[model samples]
Target: MNDDQATPNPTKDRKFVEALSRGLDVLRAFSQGSVVLGNQDISRITGLPKPTVSRMTYTLTKLGYLAYSPQLEKYQLDSGVLALGYAYVSNLRVRQLAKPYLDEFARNTNTSVGLTCRDRLSMIYVENCRPAEITSLRMDVGVRLPLATTAAGRAYLAAMKEEERRHVMSSLAERHPDTWPELKQQLEESFRDYEKYGFCLSLGDWDRNVNAAGVALHLQDGTLMALTCGAPTYLVSEEKVKNQLAHQLAILARDIERLGV
Candidate 1:
């Protein structure tokens, strides 16, 4: 099981609202693959009692956060949830500010460019720009990738201060106990590469057909973000990524950092 599946018990906090947390748990139980969920399914996923799940689903349905189908006796997310996500994306100044630059870079390179931020043990894409021609790699806004495997995530790790990086690495070690040894070794190599090259490359590490390079920078608001360019492994050679794309991405990172300053 993925580490994200282990939901923390926020209710243990003094200021935590258990009901609100449980309600969110019910809403989050639905995902890309499991779009529709019965009360029992939600209960199992959230580790909540059946009665609690039933009530939460009923409330969510009434609030338009979930839509219930009478025939299948299942619930799916409604448009209201999208409004919440839209509120987040629309309010991000970094995304609004970076669009034109990222678009130009994508067109010039004929590859995909993305801006991502860390979300726990994952890197979540906030913005993505793609060239007209389609490539084997497919990434979009809101997509999440493992922090230890992707070029964007490695760049983020490299950008963090030493103490903070150590804290996050410890958390990752605890979360993915079995894979820590291998992941740590790979991360150490990435850190060394970043120090030497000003960017890090992931050649088919995250996805077998994807080759990507990325650099990290801070936004005007001091938010850490990574900008990445990616193409299919067949289309981009490792040498070209290391010697060319990495330098270009580093320049882009510096340009973005200047905007924030």
Candidate 2:
């Protein structure tokens, strides 16, 4: 499973560039919490050889994607990565279109609203809004959530095609083998929620005192995204999440698809 392992069989797929994949994996080793790292840290995180990691860091630094810090003896992501992230998020037409509505909804409901899409085995927030009067979930853009845990993630899975859902579930199971049975049961229940309620609910399942409801949007070009409405348990009643907010979110999603260019 290590990147240094010779049989990186996924590379056998057509047009799957192994070296590029490995380099990207190296870049991904850096996160918000992991601000600076050396070859050994990246090697340990990525399961690639130290020498390979060294070479990757050198190449990435040369390409302006990473900066070498002689003082710290580590690497930090450079402007290249920032530019890429900024450019991608800025150009998301759906996020742009949904912003006003999402902001208004958040303000009116005194909750947090987020739009997210799948990233690997998780959902990455593309846009998020919160009420100015209340501080709810502090999750922001780029925050990732487990694909089976959050209401947004469950709504996303419920919206996927059957075969694709099976593939994703298989991946999730592999990623969490021991907990798969419990999580799978939760997903089945959430799917039923989606069918009956027009949205999915995560009733403090992701945390001890959080409640959330989510609806999925399938865009004209087939881009799938999920919109989530969430708040602290004390702030939002489960009855409101199940009966009111969830359905309201579903209507908002439909409006976004119908009206957005």
Steric collisions counted per model:
0, 0
Tens digit per residue, CA lDDT, model 2, 1-261: 332112335736876787888898888788525999999999988888999999999999999999999999999999999899889899999999999999999988888999998866678899999987556478878888877899999999999999888877877777678998999999999999898877999999998699999889898888998999898999998998888899889998998898754
Evaluated against the true structure, the overall lDDT of model 1 is 0.84
Q: How does model 2 score by TM-score?
A: 0.91
* Top candidate (TM-score): 2
lDDT, residue 130, candidate 2: 93
TM-score for each prediction?
A: 0.86, 0.91
Predictions: Cα RMSD each: 2.7, 2.8
Model 2 C-alpha RMSD vs. true structure (Å) is 2.8
